[model samples]
Target: MLNFLKKKAALIWAGNHVKKTQDFKLNAEIKQEEQLLMMVRTAEKTLFGRQHHFEDIHSIEDFQERVPVTDYEGLRAFIEKMKKGQRNILWTDTPLYFAKTSGTTSGSKYIPISKEGMPFQLAGAQSALFHYIAKKGNADFVNGKMIFLQGSPELEEVYGIKTGRLSGIVAHHIPSYLQKNRLPSWETNMIDDWEAKVNQIAVETEKENMTLISGIPPWLIMYFEKLIERNGKKITQLFPNLQLIVTGGVNYEPYREKMNELLGGKVDIIQTFPASEGFFAFQDDYLQEGLLLLTNHGIFYEFIPLEEYGKPNASRLTLKDVELHKDYALILTTNSGLWGYSIGDVVRFISKNPHRIMVSGRTKHYTSAFGEHVIAFEVEEALKSTVAELAAQITEFHLAPQVNPTEGLPYHEWFVEFEKEPEDLNLFSLKLDDEMRKRNTYYDDLITGNVLQPLKITRLSRNAFHEYAKAAGKLGGQNKIPRLANDRTIADILSEYKI
Candidate 1:
């Protein structure tokens, strides 16, 4: 009886959500303009606004002209002031919370989360689920237990404001309506050790009615492995009602085959694009190819053509100007007081009517050591194609430039952890190299011109990446290994574990 009641309520909510989404699609441009103006007006009196002439900003053009695009480092001074309990430094009021995330230059980055802007993050996640329910006409998953594998909810005070991992901070804000179905007791979630926590979670939820599981792809693989070990059965066999899997933090295509194998069959999956800055996009239509960009939400976006990025005269484009299939570096000016901030992500639009995008790679996370300029998207697509053709399965992989090789010319090096190694490893390497050259013309040119040799594959021992993460003190929630890097930081460390 309770299950039926929950399903009925979910369906009604989904119906209302669909109508609102339709309205957003029709007025996305206007809403985005309004969002920018409202945020400017709200923060006009703050220090940053006054410094940047926000009060004079009347249009997107004016705002863009007055404010220059910047990364976290540029705003570090104002954020430091806020951390010391300063008010109106960046926003109208002090931040309610600081969502901590790992940074490259700086050890830790604290992103302000305002009370008014935080709801949009939660709403974006709920919108994804509601869209699935509305389109699929199946709310049965809502009636069964749902698990969001996450970091500890325990938080520490940072000058009178709560601070923790984005996933941990979000855990505290789960809606009361879904609390009844949410799994892995609060006690279990608070465990600081990830492996220990997964063990406890497996013991507690294996026998329960788990219908929906949400997590990062790599970590979810760990949880699934634990569950499988406990019962010695496929995930679907253990939880016959399992219906949905929600994933984010990294691209899903690379891990899909292995995850499907673990589950014993394919299951409905929703991909989300979330960061401490904001919940940016999510897969709203299961049939659609890309994530639906949330235009009416708290964020106002700007795009810089990937080729033009870092150039002084680079064009910053608004929604009306974005072209389909062109890669652009994503910028955000949000209700949380972030203005013209480069969040380091690169996205390519797939649909324009109600804008949809695929995260191609990060602005900084690509290899260009030999002027080949190989991005994560190219390598992932190449690997996916090669894997399909060769009937091989991968557990994890990383790529770096082998600039100073012992014998041959400088080449790209791929360290791969294979779940099912191809019968002919040499053939697999050649095929992968051929596929990569097809995707990246510069890489092909380099090889043809004798500037570089074909990429070399270094097969890794099982659980190599897990050990790398563990040694680096990043063995848990939301921490992902970079797919491509110009430096040898990771590649050199991985060398010690080579098979």
Candidate 2:
């Protein structure tokens, strides 16, 4: 009865507020600068704020002129100071914790999550759930347990600031009552070894009333596969009430067909775009075309055209200035005291009315070798189409440019670790190359110009990715395998595992 009442109340709250949330986001262009000004005022006394003279920042123009765009590297000095007992540094209050962003361009990064920032995170989460409930017109999802498949919450302290994966931090911070329907209790969630944790989760959740599952695609697949192995049936058979699946952190195109096959067409999926820097967007539309950006959610956004990034005095456009279908590097000046921080993600706007975006790729994770630039989305679409045509299953793959002068011709080499081998290797390679040409005109032109050879694919034995990640200390939760590389470093490393 209590669970039913809670769920009923939640349904009412979600129904009541979802429209207001959407209305606020629709007016983001009008409110962005005002919100940014308020943020500046709130953080004026912090170390970074005082260093950059936030008092003089009366308008967006003033704020932009005084503060420069930065990534983790640019803020490392201040971060080190904060780690070494500096009070009220980057954030107004000393951060309660830091989220360790894995798979860094340089190295691992620990982003400060202050008390002031917690509300943004929590609110984003609540809104995501509410949006899901409202969009699906169902509040019964909360009546049953939802397995988040989160990272371990055994936080490590760095100079009194607790540090761990973002999912772990969120799990640790969610209210006690909310944990009633959440899977893997604190004792289970604190297991540092991922395999052990997954095994425990598989056993524990097998009999629970699981209606929804959420995690990165790969980990979710692993969990489902484990359940299959343990129960001798599909996951939907085990959890007859399973209705929805939520995914983030990585693209779902490659895994969609296989996951659906595993579930026997028993569930719907909602895609999300979340990061340790902040919760950004989620899919609400029934068609799942693009993510609805959380524009009114305490974070002021800026977009630098991909063509203009790192150039001399590039124009940073706000929500009012951005247009549809152009690739832009994401920049943010959040309420959490991130002043014009570059988030290292590139996105393409799909809609301007309510502001929707699709994450294109990482800023540094693109291939322009031989002047044939290609983004992750194009590559992903190509692979998705090719896999569908060939009826082969792919577990994991990475792309890199092989550009050695002595190698006769430069080519984009794919390191594919397949679940099921293609019938014809040469034909499969041709299909991949053709897909790339079909999606990217520049790549097609380069091929026609004879500046590059055909795309290359080096097939790998099953589970090569797991072995590789294990060797590199990145096998566990929240550690993503780098998908694209400018150089052949990842390619050369994967060469040893070739089938």
Candidate 3:
């Protein structure tokens, strides 16, 4: 009777959430504009708001004019002040919590998480599952265990504000009712080392009737690898009812074949674009070409054309006017007190009716040193095509631009750790190069004209990246290999690494 009630309640909530999301899709444009106005009104008295003359902003153009485009570095002073308990700096009140995430230059970033703003992230989580349940008409997963491979819930005080990996903080805040169906335990999640935690999770969950699994692609793959190794059988053999495999945090294309192979069958894969800054988008339709932009979810968004990026004065557009197919750098003016903030991600709209978008890459996460610009999507797509053709399995990988004066023509360098290395490595590299050249005309022209060297591959002696992560103290919990870098920092470090 209790189980029945729990399942019934979950279905009801899921139904309600699904309907709510549908409503959001209908009024997304007007609703988003209204949200933008509300954020300005509510935060108009705050330091950032007052300084930017938020109260005087009657239009999007005015808002854009008053507030210059800002990145994490640009907002560091205010963030640092917030860490020391400064009130009414960005948001109206002191941040109840601070979400810390890995930074390219700063090592880690502390983002203010307000009480009202926390729900933005939670709404995305619930909506993803609810949409899945509603679309598939399957609620059995609600009764079964959900294994979210995420960070430990443990947090440290960042100048009196609670701070930790966004995953950890979210994990610790999972609603109590849902907690009954989630694993591994808080104790296991608290384990700092990722490898050890995976082993522990495998031991604990190998016997559970898990029906849902959600995580970043690479870590989820690691967990599957450990579970299969420990039980000496397919993951399905251990939990045959597993029906959903939701992933985010990194490109899933290259990892899909291997993850599917581990499951021993094709499981439903849902993509979400949740980040430390905000839970921005989630996959809604069956085609999976784009994610439903959560436009009404207390976040006001803007987009800057990729071509106009880093210009002396680039144009920024609100959702009221974004075109399909053209890449744009995403900007946010959120309920979290972030105003005119560039989260470093780039995306392109695919559907304006429902406001669906595809995350392309980061503004900084591209290689254009030689004018042969290539983004993460291009790299991952190239790798996905090549790896599929070669039947190669990857554990982890990183890429960097190599432009040493004496090292011949500049080339893109790949440091890959393979679970199953390809049969012919040279051909594997060539196929990867060929795929990129096909996707990017500039890259093709550079190579065709002998102005650039072909993309190079260095298959790392196992666990090379892992060892580096451990040494860097990022062994677990939302840590990811930087897929593309502008310089040779990571590549050079790996070059000196021994087997």
Candidate 4:
């Protein structure tokens, strides 16, 4: 009876959120404009103050001049100030959680995400569901089990009080009645305690009827692999009613085919962009396209032209004025207390009617070693196409840039694992090179000697890269191999055979 009541309450809440989303969609254009003005006013009051630079800033260009660009270093300084109990330049209260992100290029940043700011994040996720339901003509998923494959919820205590990173804190905000009674308890564990927790989840979920699954793609992929290894083809037998699988935190494009094969190709897959800063956006039912922005929520959106980040005359755009099909670096000011924060990911606008966008890749996750800018997404696409053409089954792969001084050409070195060796390795490598040239003009120019040479491919043993990541402490939950390295430093680290 208790479980039934809890499920009922959860359904009611979901219905309310859906209703609100429908109303918002009906008034999207007007609401978007209104929200833009309100956000400008908020930015003036918080980020700019009464100074003339902050005032009378009617255009995106003017706003750019008033606020200087900030990276993780600047954010670190702000966090340090708060740690010493000093009045922070941003927020006044002690934050409820500090979300940790993977620090491949630098040390991990502990970003503060407050409790009052959580509702918007939750709403962003819910709105994605609303869009999905509308597209699929099904609203019956409100009562389904949602399994978030998130980090464990344990952290160091301060002043005899317990706190954790943002993901854990948000997990706590999940309505108690909606939570699975049979799942392993996250209230008292740290993410570092993975082995025990993985075992626990494996045991408990064996009997539970899970419907929704969420987590970083790499980790979830590892979990599914473990299940397959342990239970054989009986893995899906555990969750007979599974409907949707949601993944993020890292690129899912590379692992999509493999993941679908593992899950028996029965469930619908969706990707989301939920970060410690806020829930940015999510892929709705239009699974092949972009995510619709939650424009009127507690968050305000801004965009900097990707090519003009450090320029003195760089401009920014609000949600009301951004152009479709143009790539822009994202800057966000949220009710979560992050004012004019640059969260470091770049994205492109896909649609203007519903304010939909797609994450391109991170600002640093690109290779320009030979002046041929190849992003992570593009590389993943090229790999996917190449593998399909070769009829090869790739388990895992990584791309590293190699500069050849003798040839004066820069090329990508692909370390890939396959089920069986292709008949002709050289032909396979050339095919991948041809695919890259076809996809990217820059690579085509590089091949013609205007920029660089053709891309190279080296085959590794099946599960070789996975084993390497496991040995390096990046395997399983939340740890992912770097997809595109901008500099030789990360390249060196990835090239290392040992952890």
lDDT of each: 0.92, 0.84, 0.84, 0.66
State in Å the error of residue 140, model 2.
2.1
Q: After superposition, how far is residue 131 of candidate 2 from its true place, in Å?
A: 1.3
Q: Candidate 1's residue-wise lDDT over 1-499, tens digit each?
A: 9879989899999999889788787778888999999999999999999999988999998998999999999999999999999999889789988999999787799999999888988998999999999999989998889999998899999899999998888888899988988999999999999999999999989999999999999999999999998899999999999999999999999999999999997679999998899999999888766999999888999999998899997999988999998899999998888999999999999988888999999999999998777888899999999999999999999999999999979999999999999999999999999999999899999999999998899989999999999999889988999999998999999998899
How many clashes does the backbone of model 4 have?
2
TM-score of each: 0.99, 0.95, 0.95, 0.86
Model 3 residue 298 distance off true place after TM-score fit, in angstroms: 1.1
Give the best candidate by lDDT. Answer: 1
The residue pairs in collision within model 1 are: none
**Model 2: which residue pairs collide?**
none
Q: Model 4, which residues run further than 4 Å from truth?
A: 1-16, 22-62, 102-106, 137-145, 157-163, 187-191, 286-288, 405-409, 419-423, 471-473, 493-499
lDDT of 4 by residue, 1-499 (tens): 6556644555565566666666555666566445545555654543223443446766545555665667667567666655554443355355656666667545776676655666877777766665565555543444555667666665655332234555666666775645653244664234465565566566556566677777887667666766666677544565677777777776677677677777875777777888878887788654576776776676667788877776766676776678887778898766555656778788888887667787877777777777677776677778788777776666666677787544656668777766545678788889888888887787788779655666777556556666677667665555667667756554454455422
Candidate 3 Cα errors over 4 Å, as ranges: 1-9, 405-408, 497-499
Instruction: Kindly list the per-residue Cα lDDT of model 2 for residues 131-240, writing each as its tens digit.
Output: 88877777777778888888888789998889888888888777777688888777888887777888999988998999889898888988888899998888788888
Comparing candidate 1 with candidate 4, which one achieves the higher lDDT? Answer: 1
The lDDT of model 3 is 0.84
Candidate 1 lDDT score relative to the true structure: 0.92
Q: Mind giving the per-residue lDDT tens digits that candidate 3 earns over 1-499? A: 7767766777787788788777779788788777888888888898888888988987777787888988888889999889888899999888878888878777678888888888878889778888877777667777789988888788899768888878888886788878888999889988977889999999989999999998988788789889898888898878888888878887677787778788887578889999888898888854466889998878889899988988988888877688898889999988888888899889989998889988888898888888876888888888888888898988777888888747688888888888898999899989999999998999999999988889888878887877888887767667776788888877788876634
Candidate number with the higher lDDT (1 or 2): 1
Cα lDDT of model 4 overall?
Answer: 0.66
Please give the ranking of all candidate structures by TM-score, highest first, separated by commas. 1, 2, 3, 4
Error of 1 at 119 (Å): 0.4
